[model samples]
Target: MPPRCQNILLLGGSGLIGRYVAEDLRLRGFTVTAIARRYVASQRTSADDIEMPIMTMTADQLTHLMLDRKIQMVINCLGVLQDGPGMDTMAVHRDFTAKLLAAINAAAQPIQFVHISIPSAADSDHTAFSKTKRDAERLIAEAGIGSTILRPGFVIAPAAYGGSAVVRALAALPVADLPSDLASRQFQPVAVDDIAGTIAWLCEHGDHTHHVWDLMQPEPVTLGAVVDCYRTFYGTDRSTRIRLPGFLLDLGAKLGDATARLGWTPPVRSTAIAELRRGVTGDPAPWIAATGIVPQTLAQMVNRRSATIQDKWFARLFLLKPVIFVSLVLFWIASGFIALFISYDAAAGILSAHHFPTALVGPITVGTSLMDMATGALIALRRTSSIGLIWGILASLGYMFGAAVLTPDLWIEPLGALVKTGPAIILMLAALMTLDNR
Candidate 1:
């Protein structure tokens, strides 16, 4: 047995698996320092949390961090599903792994390394996401450190994100019949607690042999079955399962990919579809035997607890999120376009009628329209979405106040355009609240 270590460093602590593992390890009496780029306010724990850009950090910096913290173990949960703005598969999976390995090699004391990886398949290297992950695995093996690589299949955590969020949304919606080919693909799921339990077991009984294990349930299940399980959980199993066309799925993926370039990490992207088609399956016998853990079945996982009102709300809102954002974008941009080009004279006439601004009417109309368009553009990009939402709310309030003061009669207009802005502002607030994917 290897030396038992208590001080552990955990990476990607804000992620689904990382957050659970961090809390679990701390409960098991280990001193865990969690490093994440950002932490959700609701998800924040009592553990020592460090917010930093892990991707940009160098090996020297990581070494110093480990040394400073007196880390005796490292659990890496950091990873990306697809390439997008500020997200590169090679940089995250390969380059980061290489740097992390270098830091481990340079550590003054021996540090146990535990890495979370994906299940392997015949065409695993088909996509850049999978290819880079495989490259990282090779680097870890070559580093010659005391390491263990765990490949978990379709992790079923209480908290939903990424592919899991997509799955929940599909189960909640009535129009979620998948293509037969994709639906029939094998999908093996493992409970998130099982993963944390395995890590805890490793820490308690240190295994000297560098091992790679596939962590999943023993029984086989299809993608369709997994969806059915979730649907059952949501009491939507009685709904008809109309066959969804492949073309629609393709179109959705293209849209997802387009949004990814704008900094949104939509779960229905091309890479996600490609990986889903590949399916999640592996031999979990080794992991079961090694850790003495009996993985939870799909039924067991879903039926573990009753679904709450919040769970149902989340599932329904997950599907409605894209619709809300798209509608907001169109509403803002279209309003601006009409004011700038289609209704330029009418827009100027409003300001002119408001009283005495013969020289400023055109400029005010044009400037406000431009500002409206700019707000929409900012909201469309994930990075500036919050600022855009705030700008939109403020602009709407300004318009309301201006109309009430200058042309109070306009507030009682038959169209009630001003009245509708209230709901639009509320929608923007909703979008801002649900913006964070992690």
Candidate 2:
């Protein structure tokens, strides 16, 4: 049988929303080709193939991929809350959208397009993230392609990414520290699976009459209430609540902005703070009229998913990962300097006892210390962080092996300091896992 017009190509398919949408569409018997920046080999399924690391592909390469797959419709689910390092708000949301649309237009047959955007006022949206999204919408409309734009509010997902990570982290905190002025700020969080199902249904039904739909819950809930719902579901309803003043919130936003400049993408930023202060709630009339699917409320969405150990760990450690990484870098660097300060005679005596020549001790100790410091500096740098992490892991393992072979007594020493190397290596691995800030 020949493929239908709904042969879907999903961009950002490895992301929280895109993953669910692609899988949902596939289960409904639609041919899906998902493109993402990165994907694991195991994520591939019989119904779909996930092609990844496509961010660096040229426009011609992208066009070829689309054409080769016989993609009749494209669903762009790409989104990022903050820009960092290789990420640019304008490039991702505006330039890329324009280029993709142009590629689709250049194809032999016309293709339908669906864009997953967020609610934002064009004139009042000061953040680059929002402005670029608005620009992308305008470009889509001007292209005159058969398109549907979906603007959703507070998309709730099991994965901790962007705003969802922040919400989970804050809700997991022992005390909820909220901005005093934000008490009245409203939101209508919707489940990601629900949005994905709606998009899939629209694709199958060919409901292109509604150009734009605000996918949100029927009733609005306050920001505090959203957090409260999470807390209650997570069994933390009795947690203390403290309202922070406006000034403290501003200070935090500034710090978050500073971290972003350093190539670490923290969820709390000036733009996010600004958006939260203004609040986000969209009218659900259009979505309901077209789809006839009632969106789940924030509370109901929270109850649908049972909390797991992994979720709890992720919620608590999401923000602390960067802090721990930075601390590890500093410790590695400081240890090198401290070793250098040790007296030459004292170092020689220890090496002499371990059968190292007195003359060779000086060069070996100095070289190793220098290498340690260099590795730490490289790891601290954003550009070379990945390499640095590999270096750190090797260095840690080398130290342990050398100590065991040369001075086995150190392992069982009274201080047991050498045993701590295991944890240090684990920490390095953790940092390496999240080193890809782009």
Candidate 3:
């Protein structure tokens, strides 16, 4: 283990595993620099005992930072599940890994790379996600970089991962999804803490030679059993159990995998979905043999103490969602009037007094209306989110004609029906969210 991981660079240090691992490394006398896309100056963790900077930058920016900073170990904890066109399976599992390996090799100090992958993801045709993950592995091997890939099963970190968000969501939901006859399917859910332990183990070992580790739990359980544990923990209402047919889910897994390879995401990552399916089907023997480390079972890791909604201070404002929505609408209303003063009002007069007011507000109204429609349309069908979002954005821009004629009042609303683009963007996000490509 080279005594200890003295200087480590964490790519996804802001994430669940990243935070824990960074903390553990610092505790072990390692100097750690956590790299994240969302690094905040105000955010601090016990892991920073060594006073290492949390460098925030894009993928390209990271290449420069690595050389300039003289980083030793490059740990890529980057992960994604259908967040964008290029961020799909292929990108997350393969392309991103390839880039990291490339940059690490180019660094002034010889960099050792560590990556988090999933099990049964090496098969070229296992699923879209597996294929791309395998692609990433192949690329890393081809580059001949000093790297280690750890493919772990579902990591349960209630407290670290957002004990708040996950607990609240799980608390409210009933009839959680499970595999059919899950009572028999095997699973090995490990804790985020254990995963952090494993990272520490790997860093201390400093074993080089392109390798893969399947970080899994000692015992396996069925989906129903996992749900039972959750039920016992939160006293959460028993959820209606619905299991998708294996073939259907398998098909979805394959489709999702394909979409990811083509750079489509924001839906569930095909790999994770596949893992959920395997959680109820596959064996972890090969994984067990590869990593001598015995993983903790689901029971060993979860803190099932009783709790209530009151625990989450934010939920108390049960009114926040509604208030945010109302504020959003009012924002549009005010922005619309501002638009009226600048451009749309003149265009409306040109359209005819009756047409002017209605038409001027046409884009604003249509834009708001389209938000719901696009969300539904995407949920009802497959891969229609792009079209729905395009139409919605066009609808939101109905004031173009008016703004051009009226001369927009930049102080109020720069455009007729448009003031801030976040809502329109968020509305499109709603449509994207509706596609549960699981």
lDDT of each: 0.89, 0.79, 0.56
Better structure of 1 and 3 per lDDT: 1
Superposed on all Cα atoms, model 3 deviates from the true structure by an RMSD in Å of 10.1
The residue ranges of model 2 lying beyond 4 angstroms of the native Cα positions read 1-4, 52-64, 207-210, 241-264, 341-358, 381-394, 400-426, 429-438
Query: How many clashes show up per model?
Result: 0, 0, 15
Worst 10-residue stretch by lDDT in candidate 2?
A: 201-210
Candidate 1 lDDT trough over 10 residues, lowest sum: 120-129
Residue 104 lDDT (model 3) = 70
lDDT of 3: 0.56
Those runs of model 1 whose alpha carbons end farther than 4 Å from true positions after fitting are 1-3
What is the TM-score of each predicted model, taking all chains together? Answer: 0.96, 0.85, 0.59
Instruction: Report the C-alpha lDDT of model 1 over 1-438, residue by residue, as the tens digit.
Output: 543878899999999999999999888788999999888786677749778898889999999999999998899998998887788889989999999999998986788899998996646668888999888899998888888999999999999998888888888887678888888999999999999998888887755458888998988898889988999999999998788988888999999999999998888999889899989999999889887899999999888988899989999999799999989888889899999999999989888887947988888899999999999999999889889999999999999998888888887899998888889889989998888776
**lDDT value for candidate 2?**
0.79
Mind giving the per-residue lDDT tens digits that candidate 2 earns over 1-438? Answer: 433456888998877788778888887788888888766554566446666665566677778888888888889988777677777888889898988888877775767788999874566688888889999999988887788888888888766677777778778888656775786788878888778877776666554333887888879888888878877767777877676688877887887887677666677788888888777777889788877888887777888867888878877877787787778888788878777775545655667789897678889888877888888888877767888889888988998999999999889978787899898889889888866432
Model 3, 146-252: lDDT tens per residue? Answer: 67777766567644232223323333455435447433456556667667776776666656678776676656666556656655555554546555455655565
